[model samples]
Target: MKKCRASSRILLIGAGVSGIAAATRLLQNKFGNVQILEAEKRIGGRINTIPFGDNVIDMGAQWCHGEQRNCVYEMVKDLDLLDFTGDFFSGVRMVRSNKEVIPLELGQQLYGIADMSVPKGSNAEAESVGSHLAEHYWQEIESQLPQVDRALATEALECFSRHESSILASDNLFEVSGRLHLEYEKCSGDQLLNWRDKGYARFLRLLMKVCEDEPEELGALEGCVLLGKKVVKIEFIDPDKVRVVCEDGDAFDVDHVICTVSLGVLQEQHERMFSPPLPAEKVNAIRSLQLGTVDKMFLEYEKQPFPDDFVGFFCLWREEDLKQLRCSDFAWLEGISGIHKIKHQPRLLLVWIGGPHGRRVELLSDKRVLEGLQWLFCTFLRFDVPPPQNFFRSKWFANPNFRGSYSYRTTRADELDTGPSDLASPVMGGDGYPRLLFAGEATSQSHFSTVHGATEAGFREADRLIKYYESCKTNR
Candidate 1:
């Protein structure tokens, strides 16, 4: 029975956190014949960390959202890898387009309202988060502030909404389901824990059981992964065998296949990739749930402009200012919600952009982006802006492998009564055995759109197969 389990050929698609987790779990369980196919030349799919100026910066997933119940946090909590310095909101400056700096107390008050305004999973009516938040926020504003402060408060709310859009990875909060948004189970504890100077790739290395001293090593599952192997097709050649074909014309026939591609990839390639085609419900789920874009622009300064303790600034644009800015090539600047200092990288500032503008910015050249940033700073800060020595931006939308950043529950998904579970259900072959399994962040019901969620999904699928083989052995 052990030999049979060991000899069973298994194939995993994609080398992201979920894929690596699945491969590691299976290998630990004594499943010897397992392989991973990564489309990109590099591993750590969305957890990309690269050297910028003097330090490294994460181009993909950055923070560990929480400590309690968060797998990533639990794994590294004792390792002293986390940095819980300053909260994201506290002491952060809020500046308007007219070069007005909002009073610290008022700014904190407005941000507090925005932070607590999100409903906590009890909305029976399936309305948009934006609708509920706007209604509640405006009521608070009218009661809390004088008429003179209302306009600034309104602009602040818009800025907050854009920031929320980026976190939720939606085009706008209006499209995200309020109830489903709250359905996400956040791990209790600090939500903004950073990895000090170590980038998010550290989490991936830990999953693979790689040593800290050997940073460039692949650790346990090194030879198991084949990079630059873009899987173009997956077909069930028979009840017991599945054929996997790559873009480079490489093919492998395995006993079982585990797919850990992103929801964005599934939405774009599902129809053409699967031979018999996925189930109707799965297809509907793929279309219903959205994968929105969230991009980052990293600017390296020759001279540090802000104080060492400086967090960042949130931009509040008045209606008139937006109207004027929209008329120029720098219209995309309006999409930027905030600019924050990267932890441990003193000379770098990170800009967060979301929604449709995220895709728009990816198409712009570095020169254009720098010019837009200069205009934005000169107008908002009312200072002579200096050009950044170097600039780096993520093109997740433009990259075909990752159509967008991450997945979110849409109002349409709630209306259609389809979600991650529908997309997660495994396909059974003719012999009544699970032939194809799906695992990724999108498949997680309670923890979707998180690294921990993706890691958990991979473990779930691998355990399912383990239980199946155990049952077979017991029956024999």
Candidate 2:
């Protein structure tokens, strides 16, 4: 393991999972004078937890996805945080546009067919998932299947499209690259696990606690985190030194700096955020990756309106209707993939809106959002209910700090043959050493769009710097 010079200064940008993880790891490695600049007043970055009534709700990252081998999952287990299994597509009530409920069995069958359409073999990367599935259905149209079955199949595909798109937080299926969609590295086990009791913020706090060398050491590390330091520009003084200037006029000079900002932020601010501009290749790579949005609406009521056993509902739009209505219209509810009933809080309902529509919802007034939700529920349930007593919605896309919620594999960047690797590479200084390094979820090839991915990237860069300093000391 490489150990950095005790006197070398390190500046970490963004106190998100990656920045926090990097800073803690560097401290443990005996690197001193490490400073963190956070745009938000709080730590955890995208992992935000807010007080709601008697319980805590996670406005940002809510799950430790994957199973046993998952880095974040393992950490959750190590901390002994209480978690509950999340069943994907479970207890979903698929309602038709005509106000009819599709048979659960038929919905499941169509979903299975859609899943089977995804090529498991080598050709998987050669085409997009949407294209592949569309071809399958087109072939089915010519097959011996009854007209009724074919119509059902089409509806099922539409339902699947809405559901999966929301899960991917993608605008459309055709925009996703085939290889990029299915070939991501996976850790074995369940796909989802919710932090039931304390929410995900506990994990961030726990990481800070565990990274301390001694009881007093934690205080020193905590003191290093500077909140509300919105970085406006990074000026490279030389190959070995860089200066970070904040919006508030504060400046930080350090030996090495790691930027763990979101891809969306990079896209919006990269041209102005760096001195002498970024390399064309880096700029191209940044522009190539597509950032997506997934906004959450938490509806809390004073009374329960649905059955106690009902966990979630999926409103399936008629294929013909969906086709006629352009996605650009920004009919927010049409983009709602599902509504999940909070297990612990029966009065709470979580609605997921994704793609461009998700951002549209952010522009709406609270009353407007509630009215939209009321219409969706009344139309699908064939009944009316009282307005929610309280509600909360996420605005990750609109936030200048985030710009968008997550990253996705896109068709745009294939021309340059660049992906996360290009984005992750360090900007080399004139002295032949890495000066500005990048670390974030979007930069992780296998785990892009995941908290664990960001955390791992931060640790990876920190280790690199540590090793470089250790090598230097040995040579001397």
Candidate 3:
């Protein structure tokens, strides 16, 4: 920490998970003069949880999502932010196309592929879960279930359809095309309990706790980090310095700048703001990286049209009818942790939409989204339900500041592999002096689109700057 603490300066952009994590490491590393600039009033970008009734409904990320062995698990454990074991499939039910709801355990056939340990069978071909869905049929899945229980067949089909429906934003499950790049699908599944039981309003307080001002002579992640400062302009001013102008008319002189803004923010606005303009390759990479959208449609019904014990996942079939409704974006929303607290005459019914289909879904008015949702329910649920007296929804795409749901993805999964290779590399300027350094998910090729990926990328750039200084001293 001491070796690089003096004469070290870092400018971090955005206050998302990755940013905070990177800041923590920087402070610990004793990197001096680190300042983080966030556009929004709060941090924790996508991990947004809102309070409702007796429960807290997650607005941004509802699941501990990804592989259960995800790196976030370690982060939470290290931060001491976990309490429960963090399983994802308790109190689960399926809403079938026949409109009949049934318990999923009575039909384990639908879940076998999801929790199957043999991922190499599905992922070795570089085929995506969408491809897996394409090749596998309902009969094959249902054949694994008990035929004696008629509800088994109904629930099995509905659950499979629901999985496809949840991930691909396409109206049709048949349209979800891609190779599965991620074999480890266990997202830490239980971070912050998928709710703001502490509430989203209080998250800022947590950020303030760990991410506060550092001491006069602190180590990494220390006095280097500051909040409420906004970065307005950034460019390579001299051989060793990258100049940054903030919104409050303050300018910073730093060795490097790590930008981690939303894709929607970059795609729509990058052209005008960047000095000397983005290189053609950078522009192409930016264009090639797709920013998807996912809207959470929340409804508070006056009366529970569904059963009391039924905490169900709704699915549209892979057939033509499901394609027409655009419900095939993502897969399931589980009740294992049961953060929504939908027990004993629950009040909320929520759905997620992602990908290009999610982008279009955001275009519709609340009335239109609700109608589309009802149409989707009718297509899969098989039962008729009345209009909701209270409904709430999120449109991240329309918001210019956000632009889309989160991260970037395309059918070509390898391109989605963003790590150090993908992120821009910092090199010496005209006179062999370190000019500019950039860090973000897009800039990283190995671990892009991930919280840790972004944080590690920031560390990588900081390390690069330190090495550059080491080289200069050795040569002298």
Stretch of 10 with least lDDT, candidate 3: 330-339
The sequence of per-residue lDDT tens digits that candidate 3 reaches over residues 1-476 is 21245456777777765566556655555555667777666565655666554466656654333435455444444544434424433555554445555556654545564334222434534444444553554445445543545444433444455444444333333332242234223344444243224333233334344342432222333444456666667777765577878778888888666676666576777786567676665565566555555677777777666555555554424334444434443222220111122332266666665545566656667787667566655655645667877777677777655676544334443454432344365544665554555665545554455544555565676566566555333211
**Number of clashing pairs per prediction, in order:** 0, 2, 58
Number of residue pairs clashing in candidate 2, backbone atoms closer than 3 angstroms, sequence gap of 3 or more or interchain: 2
RMSD of each: 2.0, 3.4, 6.7
**Candidate 2 per-residue C-alpha lDDT over 1-476 given as tens digits, one digit per residue, 9 for 90 to 100:** 22246778889999998998888888887787788999987778889988884487888888787766567887767656755565643767777767787777666656766776664557567777678878875565445334545666667777778777776667987877776755567776666667776787766776787442343233435688888999999999866789999999999888888999999999999999999788888898899888889888888888877665556677776777566544533367777888877655667888888887788888889888887788677766865567888888899998989988888777677666789988999998765577899999888888888888888898888998887776555321
TM-score of each: 0.96, 0.92, 0.69
Q: Alpha-carbon error at 436 in model 2, in Å?
A: 0.3
Q: How would the candidate models be sorted by TM-score, starting from the highest?
A: 1, 2, 3
Full ranking by lDDT: 1, 2, 3
Which is the better candidate, 2 or 3, if ranked by lDDT? 2
User: Which 10 successive residues of model 1 have the least lDDT summed?
Assistant: 467-476
Among residues 3 or more apart in sequence or in different chains, the pairs in candidate 2 whose N, CA or C atoms overlap within 3 Å are: 2-466, 2-467
lDDT of 1 by residue, 1-476 (tens): 22256778999999999999999999988787989999999998888999896678889898888889999898899999999865654777899988898888888889878877766657624588888888888787777765647778789889899988888999988889886656788898888888888899988889888888885877889799999999999998877889999998999999889999888999889999998899999999999999889999999998676665557788999999889988989989988978987768878889999788888999999888888998888898854547888889999989889898889999899888899999899998765678899999999998998889999999999998887786444321
**C-alpha lDDT (0 to 100) for residue 331 of candidate 3:** 20
Residue-level lDDT for 441 in candidate 2: 89
Off by over 4 Å in 2: 1-4, 86-89, 119-121, 137-149, 210-220, 319-330, 472-476
What are the lDDT scores of the predictions, listed in order?
A: 0.86, 0.78, 0.52
